[model samples]
Target chain A: MDSTYINEIRRQFPILNQQVYGKPLVYLDNAATTQKPLCVIDRERDYYLHENCNIHRGVHYLSQMATEAYENARRTVAAFIHAAAPHDIVFTRGTTESLNLLASSLGQLLIEENDKVLISAMEHHSNLVPWQQMLRQKKGQLLVCPMDDNGVLDLQRYETLLDEKPRIVSIAHISNTLGTINPIKEMIGMAHKHGIPVIVDGAQSIAHHYIDVQSLDCDFFVFSGHKMYAPMGIGGLYGKSDWLEKMPPYQFGGEMVDQVSFEATTFNKLPFKFEAGTPNVGAALGLESAVRFIESLDRNQIEAYESALLQRAVEQLSEIEGLRFIGQAAKRSGLVSFVIDGIHPYDLGTIIDKMGVAVRTGHHCAEPVMTRFGIPGTVRASFALYNTMEEVDVFVKAVKKAAAMLR
Target chain B: MTIKEIQDAIVEDFSMFDDWMDRYAMLIEIGKECPLIDDKYRDDKHLINGCQSRVWLSAEMKDGKVYFAADSDAVITKGIIYLLIKVFSGQTPSDILDSDLGFLDKIGLKEHLSPTRSNGLLSMLKQMMLYAEAFKLQEDKK
Candidate 1:
């Protein structure tokens, strides 16, 4: 991508034009959460200013408008991921909540004593803890798919683990800490051969690449919108209708129930049965606007631009003495995690922040990955569509300066 | 010296630095010189849990005054802990408990004290106070 196009894209995010600690802010924390664009902000504000009312069962015009907007957001999410039906998309607070919902609902439906759930070593805690808790409750076992030192998942070992006949396979589409892009399409195929279901944690991958649930043929996929320039507290889960129909409701409340009698209550249909509350109508609208913003751009160009940013970071940062990258996967996303010989990640991060660079430091909620690598933590710099090559240069300079000070 | 006198001296020392680089450089020097906790107490038992870095703190009562030894994986955090120890060590439990840590802000290192920073300075200070309170309770029992 050209500089002019990149600059135009940067202009849409109003937060980018600011200074931090007497320096222009260089935000490389997109893996944590992305800065919102003006359109997404406006869409959310417009909902509250114009159509602020309860969704679903309401007779008033404002209520109907709000309900239409919320449902439309659901449909937009469905189309974004290429789900078979709008009902397959369930609105969630974010990826963590979506995974927890699956763990709870699916555990009740599918998990039995001695059953197994397989997950990759590179999964973030959101994907790891939920399944561990679920399996513990069901008296089932949790099998881990190992990764090599380069952070690539071992396909041979993963294939071998599949012979254990795990009830489900939960894996990250892209690792938040390592940035390894797991071959979930092939992993799903292998799991399906053994009649095992798979859940793809697309929290990191959804913003970086296009997703087609039908093509992947995975049982379920989950992602958060905030990482893609939407407001927080809004995300989605796309599950196959066959599985969703059989699963129980995740929460019990007003919207999820059809009829609440003295003795028992009948739950609502596919998406509603999972929602269970008044819902975040404004954030849902913001998420839809973010999806539209991404669709408006040339996705292929954006992907290529981000990959270049990651490459630039790797090449430049590798020149620094004593700095070692943690994850060097053959197939990776637009992030890099590394540690210096003697300097701790927290110390480096603190100094880097003084230079107006925002990067994530520490285990990134992937303590298992840290243990696997035999390190305390790593400093991760993640790139996004709006991140510029110039910003990457600034980040590299900041890291170099911080390393000098620490050394 | 009393805790107040020591904190005042630290504030005066830090006042010489005009920018963050000098301030952090001094902190890094202090970290290098900071007394480390014995390896025996450096396990999970003495570990301060909240900070992004691993911090080990141990305290003992000598002649009715508390002395502390602490260590951290991060140099900046260790330096901050050294500062905390300088202020509170060799002080009576009551004096340590009664002391205020507003000197952290006066030294322009207030950001480290923020809970969001996750550097464990705040947790370290709290742990020190708890150690003093425990010693006081034991004295009361005696």
Candidate 2:
């Protein structure tokens, strides 16, 4: 891609053309949540301004149009993830809710006393806590597959942990704090061999690269739209037909009911069975727009550009004295997390913010990952497609100054 | 000077620094000047939770005035607590209770503190007020 293409992409995101603390903003907090582009924002606004209505129930024109747009958004997500059918997709509040729905429903379906649920140590709290609570309720064991010193999942230990025959295996596609991209294909295959289903938390991975649920062959996959430049409060969960067929509906309400009688109520079909009550129609349209935006940009080019940006960030940030990166995984994604000696991540983060560089401090919602590494937290700089090398230079200079001040 | 006068003085001092870096350096110096908490009072009972960094606060009443001592693991948090102690310590319980603490906003200190750190600052302030309220109750009983 040329500078013109990159600049055009940057122009679409209006939030980037601003200042913070009297300095030009260099937003490197994409891993937390991405800023929306004009198209996604406008699409959501258009839904409210022109097409606003409760979906799936009304007889009026606005309702029909909204239902079509809402269902079409499901199809867009289904196509984006290459699911077998739009019926395989379920609308969710976000990745956290999706994981909770799965854990609760799947736990009820699969987990019994003494059954095990295996998760890696690198998972965010969203992916970890539900299983822990579910297993505790079921009197089942929640086994943690340890990660190596460098933040790579210890496959040897995972293989051993699988010997216990966990009811299901859940893992992250990418570590939010460490940026370790797990070998999902091989891990899924390994779990499948043991007759266990796997759920891949793609909250971090979905924004960075292509994901095909059918290709990955995992029983389920979950992601948040806000992490990918869509509006917040919209996400999707893609479950294989077999799992969705077997599992009970996560929530019971209107539209998820096939027939409501005074005596007994039968539930609705596949995707609707999970989504309860009135959905986020505007957010769904925004998510569809975000998906269209990604499709407009070549996935291969986005991946390559992000990889190069990460390289530049790593190279530049490594030059700072006493700065040590948390995760030194061989394969990583579009983020770099580090801690400087004699400076708290909070202090470093505060100083950097004053210079108008937006980075995430603290545990990044993966307190377990920090516990595994025996550190309080790390300062993370996550890059998105709009990020330029010039912004990285500003971040590096600001970080160097921050380190000097704190130390 | 009164507690409000001291806070006004601190706010005026912070106003001299146009940049955050200079303000932070001055704040760190204020933290360095904070009197250390006694080892006996450094136990978990006196320790304030909810702080991203560990903080221990000790309060004592002598001649109807409340004296406070504090320590923190983080420099910035320590500095914030030190600033808080400067305004609250050596004041009567009633005087401490009536304090508005608007100087924090005037200096932009509250906004400058990160979310977690600001929560910690609030936790510290609450503990101080609780101490003041408790001393006030003791005096009432007497």
Models 1 onward score TM values of: 0.99, 0.97
Q: Residue by residue across A200-269, what tens digits does model 1's lDDT show?
A: 9999999989999999999999999999899999999999999999999989997999999999999999
lDDT of 2: 0.90
Docking class of 1: medium
Given candidate 1, what's the lDDT at residue B71?
94
Segments of candidate 2 deviating more than 4 angstroms: B32-35, B39-43, B112-119
Best by the lDDT measure? 1
* Interface quality of candidate 1 as DockQ: 0.79
- RMSD (CA, Å), candidate 2 to true, equals 1.6
Q: What does candidate 2 score on TM?
A: 0.97
Per-prediction DockQ comes to: 0.79, 0.48
Give model 1's clash tally: 0
Estimate, for each residue in A1-407, the C-alpha lDDT of model 2 and write its tens digit.
57688899999999999998889999999999999999999999999999999989999999999999999999999999999999999999889999999999999999999999999999999999999999989999999999898899899999999999999999999999999999998999999999999999999999998998888998999999999999999999999988898899888897999999899999988888888899999999999999999999978998999998899989998888888999999999989999888777877787789899999988888888888888878999999999998888899999998888777
RMSD of each: 1.0, 1.6
Candidate 1 residue runs with Cα over 4 Å from true position: none
